[model samples]
Target: MEHAELDALLTPEAMTLLDGLDPVQTTNDVARVVTRLRAAGHGPELVSAVVGQSRLRHRAAAKFGEFAGRMLFTRAGLEQATRMSVSAHHAGRFARAGLRRVADLGCGIGGDSLALAALGLDVLAVDADEVTAALAAYNLRPFGDAVEVRHGIAETTALDGVDAVWLDPARRTTGHSETRRVRADDYSPSLDWAFELASRIPAGIKLGPAHDRDALPEGSEAQWISVDGSTVELVVWTGTLARDGVGRAALVIRGGSAHELTAPADTPDEPVRELGAFLHEPEGSIIRARLIGDVARSLGAGPVAEQIAYLTGDADARSPFATTFRVRETLPADPKPLARALRERGIGTLEIKKRGVDIDPAEFRKKLKLSGTEKATLFVTRIGARRTAILADRLE
Candidate 1:
């Protein structure tokens, strides 16, 4: 959105009109809403802007919940904004460190800044993009004097009186129409500069989950977080912000519950063992954090194969860190034989899962010729050096 469009969106009349309209949740809904809005005497620009915003608010609900209803967002800003649940955890880190004021570098749409202000920390939220900074100012207006949104580069933003820093360098290429992922070295403030600043002050840097681990600065706590079942982001905490004696950790959030596993360093995986009565699929956070050994130990299990993330043991052992499946039987790895075997067993419905393999599940499913009344999950992966398939039932 341009400055004038944003100004229009923030006006009393525009806000009142937006408030009176229900959220547009789908593309089909957008057409009907846009038509009704235009017919109601709203100008074309206002209708288009409001309609676009309504759709964004509906999409943002997954990340910001009810707060999305009142916030302003751009397409790219909303796409890159941190989830509210994760931001709350980030804000709590500053709160626990006794930090009262924080410099939120590269604070897109004030997502983290909002969380910080909610925790009572004064925030200086900065974004280099003019429109984004303005949108951030609007979004953070509810915080009153607690937040100051500035249009400035994070590298040059004044840091006076800031007790800590929360730097989320722009990881995507700059564009007015589209943005694409850039490498770690290409970060807006750059990882080198970000880590240098962190070395001098307590700071938390948010990076993508796939960021090169070897490049992470020493003496920091690297944490991988998974919300629901997806590995969302990796945050490296430095100085006092880093948790004591914790070098690496995985935080899994499902529903409203959180479970964390940490180690002073990466732990060695348990020895590979034969497939037992059950199979365990570790959460993405656990796999990314390389803490599968910890989960395996807790469940009295071991890896099903070398270099594989799957774990196996008795059917009774369970942990929040992994999804356990009861082993029904092993199936033939060959497609024709596997299809025939499944047909004989009366298994029709299937949930296909794979790791350490190249076959696309959707394409492979079409070749199965599935037919039956029974339903089951099929795990296509490796056991030692051999390709294997395991049919199982999901244990709730």
Candidate 2:
């Protein structure tokens, strides 16, 4: 098409071509639109024009996902920190705590605030950026007389007589870097300062899940939450984290493999139990939460090492905390014995798992020409610094 023709189509005609293609402003989504345009033979010039105009539109459409009032949080809160889904239970933790009035500091599109508002609480949602604040207001508008979205700095924003607070500091600036780390005293609209301004209220400030554990504040409950076998976020609750972390918090999203783990206090050190016919590898969440004691207590088992998450039992103990398998054979952690054991079992295509052993499965699999009609889960580890393997099967 000629330049004039393209210009002619630039009106409603061109608009119709891009209709329903409301692409998001995110770099990823905008790139996707550009890729699609490329496939349509819309050259770089046309693509650049679309990106400048349609990127934000695409981001909005993508996030909303055809659902009304789909709560959107800051990308830093969700993406940068490994959080994917904000479980209903998590949302309720803050909402049910009698937080009648809340200043959702750095409220990215109002994810948490909406939940609070849904609970019939009056919330003041604030974000630093003008565009984000506008989007937040647009998203929160349906609540009607419940949620008020504002564009301003949390440190200077007028936060008068609010009940509680939720501040998710901007971990990174747009140009990108760890540029924002406001102190509790420096908290926007300054809740840290506001405690003096008004009253001390329950606050939930989300930081990196990988944050220094030892630095955890006194009496602050640290919660590591995961959904569908993936660790999502670590939250520090100034007041209430949960009833009893119970070692593992499996946030199941219906038909998904539940995320499970044991808490730090739950780590087991009650002396290593004797090796049994079965070896169990505790799920990752359990390892992080240090819920081995809880898992052992639940499975009626004990740890193979004082520190390792691996649990052992004389009889098979079925547990979600660990993958349990019945034993078919055993050998020293050395290669010759392992090779012989595999040959005897006629087992090949080995599924290697290790808790304490440093032996590489790739190097070992190359040595064992094994195949079998029967199988077992091998618990590879160092028993008193001597490598060992305990073959086992899934506990019924």
Candidate 3:
């Protein structure tokens, strides 16, 4: 949003209009609201700002829940903000360590700062963008004197009184909306400066889940977190916030429950073995943390093929770290033979999963020419040196 539009949106009249309007969710909703507001004699700027904000609030609900109704957001800021559930976990680290004051550097829309303040910890939330800083102040207004929102550069901000720091350096180009990803070398405040700050004080640095592991600093705990089935972010913990002797961690959150697997360092991969009755696909967080070995040991499983993430075992086991599938049968790997085999089994709806294979699932699905009532999953993968197809059923 432009500064003028933001100024228009912040007025008492605009805020009340936004609050009174029903939730705007679709293009139809936007069009209807725009027409009604324009007909009511509201100026174009106020109408556009309110309509745009309403649309953003609908999208932000996935990350902020019900709190999104009152909060404001820019497109890029909302996209980069951490989910409320994940932010609470980040806040828990500081609260558990007995840290009372935290400086949340690059506090986009105050997602993490809100979580920290909600736990009764004082917060100094700083964002380099003026509009983002204003939105942060508004979102964190409920915390009253406990939270202070500042418009300033994170590297130059004074941290004299804070007990710890939470750094989420800008990984995208500068903008209030429509920003593109920037290279790691171009990160705002610079990783070098951020890492140096972490070394002297308890800190948590949030980065993309796929960040290069080799580039991470030594003697710190790297934790990859996945919400539902999607791996979200990697957090590097230093000083007191870093758990003793733990170098890698995977945290998986599915629905209301959460599970964590931790090891002193990257666990070695298990030796490859023949396919067992059940196949296990490790969660993204586990794969990213390189802690699949620990989960495999717990489930009495081994890799299906060398360097493959899929695990196989005969044991009846269920784990939060991996999804288990019961093997039904092995089929011919060739597309023509596989289609014939699937047709003979009366399989109609097929869930195609592939690894170490070049075929696109959608195109391959069309080639099957399927026509039946039964449903099954087809795993197109390599077994040792040969390509193979495995028919399986997901074990809930």
Q: Pick the lDDT winner.
A: 3
Tell me the number of clashing residue pairs for each predicted model: 0, 37, 0
lDDT of each: 0.91, 0.59, 0.94
Q: How many clashing residue pairs are found in candidate 1?
A: 0
lDDT of 3 by residue, 1-396 (tens): 889999999999999999999989989999999999999999999999999999999999999999999899999999999999899999999999999999999998999999999999999999999999999999999999999999999989999899999999899998887889989999998999999999999999999999999989999999999998899999999999999989999999988889999999999988787899999999999999999888899889999997788999999798999999999999987889899999999999999988887889999999898979999899999987889899999989
Candidate order by lDDT, highest to lowest?
Answer: 3, 1, 2
**Which structure among the candidates has the greatest TM-score?**
1
Error of 1 at 59 (Å): 0.5
lDDT of 1 by residue, 1-396 (tens): 876677778778788878888878888888998889888888877887788888888889999999999898998999999999999999998999999999999998999999999999999999999989988998999889999999999888889999999999989987533799987778999888999999999999999999999999998999999999899999999999999999999999998998899999899899888999999999998998999998999999999988899999975788989999999999887789999999999989999999988899998898899999999999999987788999999999
Q: Give lDDT tens digits, candidate 2, residues 1-396.
A: 233333433455345545546645577877787888789877676565445435433344332334321333333332332222353444576666766787887776566676677677788999876655665685688888788888897777776878767767655543111245544444344334433332245666665445556655554555665444454555656643333443224232313344445343545444588776666666555555556677777777787775676777767677765667666656766777777877787665567777666768777767665677665566677777677777666665
What TM-score should be assigned to candidate 2? 0.65
Local error of candidate 1 at residue 19 (angstroms) = 1.1
lDDT of 2: 0.59
Query: Worst 10-residue stretch by lDDT in candidate 3?
Result: 174-183
lDDT of 1: 0.91
Backbone clashes counted, model 3 = 0
